[model samples]
Target chain A: MMTGAAAIAAGGAGSARQPRNAALPAVIFAIFALMPAFAALTAQHYLVDTGTRIIVYAVAAVALDLLVGYGGLISFGQAAFIGLGAYAVGILSAAGIGDALVSLPVAIAVSMAFAWITGVVCIRTKGVYFIMITLAFGQMVYFLATSLAPYGGDNGLTIDARNTIAGWPVLKNDTAFYYFAFLCLLATYLLCRALIASRFGRVLRGTKENATRMAAIGFTVQRFQLIAYVIAGGIGGVSGFLLANSTEFVAPAYMAWQQSGELIVMVILGGVGTLDGAIVGSAVYLLAEEWLSGLTENWQVIFGPFLVLVVLFARGGLIGFCARLRLRHG
Target chain B: MTATLFFVQVLNGLQLGVLLFLIAAGLTLVFGVMDFINLAHGVQYMLGAYLAVAFYGVVGNFLFALIMALLASLAFGLLLEFLVFRHLYERDHLDQVIATFGIILFLNHAVRMVWGAAPLTLPMPDAFTGSVLLAPGQLYPVWRLVIIASGIAVAGGLYLLVTHTRIGMLVRAGATNARMVSALGVNIKRLFMIVFGFGTMLAGFAGVMIAPIISVEPGMGTNILILAFVVIVIGGIGSIRGAFVAALLIGLVDTLGRSFSIDVLRLVMAPSPARTVGPAIASILIYVLMAIVLFLRPAGLFPARGR
Candidate 1:
């Protein structure tokens, strides 16, 4: 798989060496795969639901990593893509089209279309300007959704049931949905990894490192970036579709900037540029969020300083931190 | 009647613009000088409103509470700079964004814990509480006019300071060519602190002034923070003049857009759809403007660091 080369692709841009070992990613995936059975054994039915939720968000986080980590494009609007995807499903289901056959493509297409249109304008700006513009566009999505009176407005829309898989009632079972989401996550992971290892991925990496130099060497940097942006949006759409199914509801809050920030936080927490780190990061973040909120209502007070400390100390996120730990013991 | 309403909306826009300048002034200065992105800057504005309310509860004098709150928020900003932000100045933008974002979460929640989630209020001072007649059947609140005057006064004062003073020269120099200024033996760290403190104080001042009109609550900074970001991006990073112009432009555009979007849309479409589309467009009017500005001028309208 040329693990070192792929890690270097992400590492060199972040200026932090991404560990090349496949162990961490495998372990995380193993845990994800075993989650439903573990939940059933423990009789904690909600654990399956939690596992499904994590898988859904992890999908979005991975796509976000494709942007922030691999491409060096810090889009603060990833959640807007997710919102577009979910709304596609929600709106379609309301129109009596509840089959995945119809909703899936609609969800993915709408998000990609949005990503393409916004990417054209967004890729023109750089640095903080890029962040602000993405955020502004995300806000545009949020306000638009809130004004959707027919679709429930500020309160959000509800789907009565899961979308049928080709007219088969396959996704109605919680266990089935869990595996369904797990498979989707796997597909997204493999797709992102494949993308990062391809020539297109290499050019994106080259552009990230030195766009001017790449441009000098005859690469249309913005066009490549726009494509990556659109692809990531498509993946975010997948996450949103899963999320809508799991919750059976979608709201304007799906597109909120805060949700976008959390996705970025999740990517950073796992270790930017590590595709599996995105999955690990969201799982860790959401689990911690659940546990902490249980103990204290003002959990953010503890969590906030914790994030500050992580930024100050954890240079390459949890993955980097663990690599250093292994080296120390070795 | 239509003319008076339009005039009133213009003043409302100017008022909103003035408040934005207060927040953006500090944001642009810190960003321009330190090259640090403080996502928590909005919380500083929220803290200002909260502190003002607390001080008013104790002191019972609007003027005294305002001064005390500004000083308190300034001190707090300095404390944050000393503790967390100073370390992040040398870090990458990603780390800076995360750390400050964490601070925003902390403060917004901490404020919730302390003040409760319910919105609080700061009453207008008795003297300025009255409304002044603008025209027949048109009366405007005097406090809003005070906000505009004070905002302009701050802008004028900042202009003089940047143009005339030695420290201001260092700030301008720092913004344009920071490394060069540092090589010439200026204590850049101290300069950063001074600018950061001043910016924080201005944000706090704006919050105090506006607290009377709006409900003071947790996470108030989040929404306004986005607006401040928009203002700075449009105005050009590191340019106070840019902030002033962009702030007013956004304020007027946003306010008037919200007020008249439906009427404008009605001209091109049926009233029913127009009613639905108007608010959505109005909400994004500034963003659309931001996109247009970025498309035409990627570096912003007034790039202070002239390439």
Candidate 2:
């Protein structure tokens, strides 16, 4: 599968020397499979919990990269769908359906519906106009959350308990939930890798390079892009579900434009379009944020300038920078 | 509400519009001339307020503090343009957007670190302390009236500079086509800096003036920045006249909607329901207006070019 995907990626490569890429799913699964024993050896509950959160975000970040990196759609409202997913679980639990099976589908359905509605208008514009429109839509949802009187409004809604699966009591334990999240992350990575390597993914990548050329080739560009948008939104919803469950709280702030911005930063910081890069990026970003905030409440004062430097000086993000160093040494 | 209250709100709206116009002027000019979509422009406004507070602390005189603050803001804008923004001109809009957004994050938080997240206030000068009767029974703040007057004065000055002066003609040319202006031997880099710096100062001045009334705090400019974008979009990007008209229009609609939306709704519905729904709908009015304007005129109301 790795060789096959690499061959497909090579078909588009103009350069003679194709970059040696490792298969990401196998790498991630092997590490996560070892996570439990490692946690046991280390006696660290914090590691397991933090690791679970990172995997959740990694899933969402990869989904976001598919749209932003490959489809040329820069959405600053990805969190809107993530929050939608989380709220799906919370709202359902409140109404007496606390099963993960029911809540997950509800989350996916809600996210798809949101993507369809927002993507319709958003897809019409390109460039800066596109950015602002998506942002406004995100704000509209944020306001909707704030206005929701029954589900806690600005204060936020708290879950009654962690979601259960078929009366197994699997997710009641932190270690079990950690593995559950890890499994979801692994599934998402494989699904995304397959999607990006599929024939449809080729068309999407071509459209990103030059939409006019792709359209001229008889592709229904908007439909393809919209489909991609829905997929990303659905995946983002999964992360939101994980987040809501992890914290057992859902708030409008979770879907704020700023959160969307941070998600974008995470995607770019990792290496936009690289599946493994998303995981690495989310880990780096979340950890940096956690450590920095602990160090100083004004962590953003330092983080902000760091981002500017990354944008101004660095190209292709942390992954790209590492790849460059490898070439220089190798 | 009394006639005077209505009149005062109208005056208040105009004053707000004036401040918006000041910020929008530079934004329009930068967009028109440089074709740069700057997310960091709001930080310039935030910096202006912060600078004014700092200057007031140092000078202890309102007028001198404002003058020095404006200059400081202008200098900072020029410095940023020189250092960071100039590199972005040849890049894609996505890269520019990302870079500027980074600046916004840095500056908003930087201000918080410096100002301690607590809202600061600028003292109103002794001369403009009292209210004057606007209509038979309505007393309005004299300081607000000064704001309206000064805003108009600055607008007039900007108009003259852009239209009648040599540099202004060059700026007009630059707005239409930066390449053509450069081809004509104008120092385009200098012009960009001057335009950006001036725009930055105007945003800052608007911030300084409003700092007396509104709380000077971090993230204050974020909401206003979005509102300014709406104004410029409606007014047509790159057109100062359009910004002025659109700013006033937004000011009136927003202020009036906030004031009478409930009453207007009450006329047709139950008072209790109207009271609850009116404010929510009122808050959404400008965004709805923006969506409508975008639908009708995608480029904007007064697009710089006919296209």
Give the native contact fraction of candidate 2: 0.32
Taking the tens digit of each residue's C-alpha lDDT, what string does model 2 give over B186-289?
A: 89999998999999999999999888888899999988888888788788878888899999988888898889889899999998777666776777777777
CA deviation > 4 Å runs, candidate 2: A1-20, A23-37, B1-4, B267-276
| TM-score, one value per model | 0.97, 0.91
**Clash pairs (backbone) in predicted model 1:** none
Task: Supply the TM-score for candidate 1.
Answer: 0.97
Candidate achieving the largest lDDT: 1
Residue B13: error of model 1 in Å? Answer: 0.3
Q: What are the lDDT figures for the candidates, one per model?
A: 0.90, 0.81
lDDT of 2 by residue, A1-330 (tens): 012232234233211133535854466568777877798898876878778878888888889888877777888779888889988988998898888888988898899899998788778766555666677677777777776667887788999988989756678888888888887888888788788789888888877766788999999998889999999999988998888888888998988877887788888776666767678778888888888999988887777777778767765667666677788999
The CAPRI classification for model 1 reads as: medium
